[model samples]
Target chain A: MCAQKRAKSDVGEGSPARADLDRTRAVLEGPEIGRALTRIAHEVLERTKGGEGVTLLGIPTRGVPLARRLAERIERVEDRSVPWGSLDITMYRDDLRLAPARALGRTDIPAEGIDDRVVVLVDDVLFSGRTVRAALDALNDLGRPRAVQLATLVDRGHRQLPIRADYVGKNLPTSLRESVTVLLDEFDSRDAVLVGPAKARPAPEEEH
Target chain B: MRHLLSAGDLSRDEAILVLDTAKELAQVSGRSVKKYPTLRGRTVVNLFYEDSTRTRTSFELAAKRLSADVINFSAKGSSVSKGESLKDTALTLQAMGADGVVIRHSASGAAHRLAGWVDGAVLNAGDGTHEHPTQALLDVFTMRERLGHLEGLRVAIVGDILHSRVARSNVLLLHTLGAEVTLVAPPTLLPVSVHTWPCAVSYELDEVLPKSDVVMMLRVQAERMKDAFFPTAREYSRRYGLDRERFARMQRDAIVMHPGPMVRGMEISAEVADSPRSTVTEQVTNGLSVRMAVLYLLLGGSESGIGNQEGQA
Candidate 1:
């Protein structure tokens, strides 16, 4: 995992990294994401013995689609629906000012209401672990879960917080100056994970 | 320091404490960071089902000032308008792991239902005409900032008390803060069981203006406004509006306040709202401070239970 420049701010909005989101979208839909999420679903089912009372929670934006796909795959294999909900974890980030301001998304839980259920947190990629830590804090405000597990489509690990995805689809290692971008078909036309230079750059004056 | 669901929830002492804290927070609003990080990483969601630019935006800014990550959720053009139930929407917030939910809804008791639905702290930003706790809190904060004390003070809240959540919240909260509140509205515009409230009733704003230490004008909500509440807007303004003549009746020290999005010449003339004695603009400024005080004390600073925790230090 990339560990260089830990203080690097997010490449957001007008940042060039945002422009390259299209490239990441192509990678997501192109057989690779389909293969990865399917593998993760299979592993989750094998570990949980067909996900009895397990709730699949997707962190907002990217995580939501991944969670939906995992739930569909789990249902097809098990012949029963696994409860699914979407979470907006924007509030939980430790470094809020590091990224551009964003509107909060929807976090929708199933009717069963989280109590006594095994919750599996879904995210696109596992980077600094700060997102998951924030998710933990956010989960506390929800009802008590019997147990909570973490799942990630990409484990490009650079652990800032003491967090680890319980279920991992694939692990890729890279330098700190690199970035991992995940795109899905629902919001993006293609599915892909791209390894690229950090999109954040200095002002135009420092271009030389 | 708990969720401010209603102004009535705060006792006189609690109200004073919040105002005092707000004064201190106002001093640092222009700093480079312009943030305290007091609620660092704490999630505050603006789950608004009703359309509101002023209230929603103000609450969002308030949360941001305290260093809370604010998520603005507008129901318009979303799945919510497409028949997605409130339960579904609330579950979404729960899954997102929101820390605090500040909600505004057209339907009364929407906040109550949301409280039962989410495990997070629920604050009623504005729940129909049932109550608007923060608005009332800010109004009180404005009053305390200008008047110094609330006890034995005469506060006249004029206009559509029947359809105003702000009026309902203010009346209850002001009385709790030891102020004598008089509700001046047309008899037809008063609530059916208005006498159950802590404040006295008056059909005439002019008759009550002389005795008032504070004059608070409530907006005549244009959308839900039913006719015959008064003959016409002009007549209502003539009777209840704080125009120059009405303003002259108020004590020289009496401050005027409005929750805002004011209809310049309708409820109050522009001159009265812009007057030196008016606390209308100050109400907006005080809103952030009061909200900051609420978020900090509820989520942090548990060390100060009440009354002089500083002396021990």
Candidate 2:
């Protein structure tokens, strides 16, 4: 995933980059990330019965590249093309009022609507499952899919919702203070997954 | 980017970001599914103190396309009709948890005023003669669509400048995007401080036409005219209106634009308005995508999440 620029002024206590440098550590490097995706692709094919009528919808940012890579793998194995698109869940998130306003990303749905087709949502990391819940709500508005499944590079277990990924590259149990950051070649010009302590920052009003 | 009250508030990068986002969102319109779930649970209020069809509808549609729940509060039907103050109305929207307020008011700087009163993001639809930032964005979006770029391109804004919020906003925004703007209007219609703006002033429309890559025609507000800005409608048409003759003189690739509600004979002839070079219709369509982009950026999407992070920080 591309490194989202967290504003320096907005970082509550210490320098965000400095804090990242000190506390964050890589859990999976480039080669490991590639292997995980390959295994997930095979699992997806096995689950969906050779990937027929399956459409890959990547959640924006890292998920998009992950979805594309999965589709490429599915094509090479199954020998059939799988349609892919990007799903932006900004509007459907439940915590919109609780959090600051976010920028909307592109929602590029394939020309063939999701109706009666299997949809596999791809993402870099599955944390909290809030994004998945929002993605489900977003997908419902587009069309009724035959089945909706999720494939993630990492599942840092602390799901606040009743959502689970059918295909998980790694299941890393993490605490509330820890965050899993994903890096993809398509965005960060490298592939890796990092686990770091998420500092308890002050609330927006409390910040300078 | 938080509160788009004026075109002057935008830097070149911020303006380009909106345009780029609009370009990406424009693709959604062609898809099998026209809606996106970016703002599904968010509330967007369209608060209009002035009567406007195009802008209000465009914003409403833009919000709807992004799956935002829109509540259109017009002055004639709303509590404002009962003399409720802007502050009271803002407080009410705040109480109801509106995530964004797209406001159009008759008074200049009304949106800016509303911004200070509301906690949610405030988008200025058109605040009197001060600015209509989205309209300018859409115009720039259309210009870039036609010409492929705005840098160093010549744009002639023709007709009323004094009472035109469109002209004012366009000058500010186009200038920021690296385009050279020339305001072509009768001296009486030009603002007194026109020289202070980052543009050239021109009295001859014909001279500016051949050199301009884009010609934007402003709507002459007949109702707002208390004094004679021009001798007669016929005289204005003959002198400043973009008729077939002037249209022919423009570069063959030159695009004609009008922030609509056009007085066909007074500011633009029917022939030219309907001509192939005119982007009046496209502007309306582009308005939806442009508004969508602004709302998306301000509200926070994953790709452009830079907006809301500041709120928490």
Candidate 3:
């Protein structure tokens, strides 16, 4: 009976999907993901003069793979390695208590650090711009980069903050009722971007 | 959901999540910058009702390392020593807008009672002999770090189980994580409710030592001993103390562990305590990361930053 109680709590009473998002359409596919990352890699190299002092800090989960893929492409083009690491903005986020608690993701800044370097922050989807704000806050604590730029696979517009991506792969406008989902091989074992209408969020229980 | 009052309060998944989060955050310490902006703009008050330099300092460091504002409140001075009640003290902290409270109290279940008075997260640093949830989390974190896993591991806890909130928390947590536990101590030192705990009891330390993967030596609380739990400290050392010879008899890869503030000769010898297999110091270092994980989870702001990357619409 105690084990049963533990089992229930193990998964957590907190709902993972607070809002039920219904799948509508698949926007980007596996091959398209590969092509988009390659293109972003070239754009990153061109903007910063052949990847000199360039560092790619993925915003974890999908962003990590996107960063790595870009690094590989940049390395091939520039004939030099690009310093890469992961920056987890879980703690820096603004909407922490507004949603169910999320587990912390990996924050690995390279040993040499992001100081005096052109650091490119990579993420899968760009939405409310709050995540980018949190990422900026997280980067400030690490070390001041020479210049910090944002890159994303999709920029589904309705940004709450005045933040905008530096190198956006696709500028797909999204509605308030829809959610953008980015599935990466590193996490979901597949590469695809899907847009869908959000199902009604369960009404939170009323306090007595 | 808002408080960590006991080890049993964490489900298997929550426990693992804390450990996993600690594992990720542990990398932060390795970096030259050794800081994360996770808890910035947050206030964490270490309201220690008991005298504890290590636990309080560890929590303070954890909060600061995460870039959170920390206030170290000790019961030694201030209104607490002026006969002010715990409720009033808590209310004062609440009024100050404490985002989280890391409390250590002399009374059992003080953390639980404090949870009722505060809207912020309450963490039981060590509440009498009831539970030290973070300590247990760190112990298991150290165990998992050394053993690479906790499943099916043999852990023999020695010395003062009766007065140990660490032992109580460890037994519950380790059992939940599928580790077999055996409490090796004098029958007198064992609690009256020991039989109900999810662990085995053994008076023969030598017999249990050979089969154990982790031998945890708890501090013999001389202050708490009203009656003679054993004949003498010398006799207790000869029979149960982890001397070099006794340590040699265990599995070669077997590690020695203590929860700190260890009595050098009474429960564990200096040789065994300082040996390569000992994780006493690692337990302290791991304590910082484990406490950071707890504070992050409870006051970590949003639960939306984990596993699944996609947030709500």
Task: List where candidate 3 sits over 4 angstroms from the true fold.
Answer: A1-23, A201-208, B31-37, B91-97, B302-313
lDDT of each: 0.74, 0.81, 0.81
A106-200 in candidate 3: lDDT tens per residue? 77777778889999999877777777888887788778899999999998777777888999888888766655667667655777777766435
Please tell me how candidate 3 rates in CAPRI terms: acceptable
Q: Positional deviation of B271 in candidate 3, in angstroms?
A: 1.4
Per-model TM against the reference: 0.58, 0.83, 0.88
Tens digit of lDDT per residue, candidate 3, span B1-313?
A: 3778889877788889889888877877766578876677889999988889889999999999988999999988789889999999999998999988889998998988888887677888998888898899999999999989999999999999999999999999999899999999988989899999999999999999999999999998887778878887899999989998999899999999999899998889999999999999999999999988888877775442222111111
Model 2: number of backbone collisions: 12
Cα-lDDT of candidate 2: 0.81
lDDT of 1 by residue, B1-313 (tens): 2355777777666666666656656644643346554577779899898888777888888788777899998889778878999889999998999877889998887887787777666788899889998788889888877888778889999888888999999998888878899999889878999989998999978789999999889888877765657778898888888899888878888888888878989999999989999887788888887777666555543332222111121
Off by over 4 Å in 2: A1-25, A201-208, B1-3, B20-49, B62-106, B110-123, B292-313
What is the alpha-carbon interface RMSD for each candidate? 16.3, 5.2, 5.2
Predicted structure with the largest DockQ when compared to the true one: 3
Error of 2 at B96 (Å): 8.3
Superposed by TM-score, candidate 2 places the C-alpha of residue A102 at a distance from the truth, in angstroms, of 1.5
**CA-based DockQ, model 2:** 0.23
Ranking by DockQ: 3, 2, 1
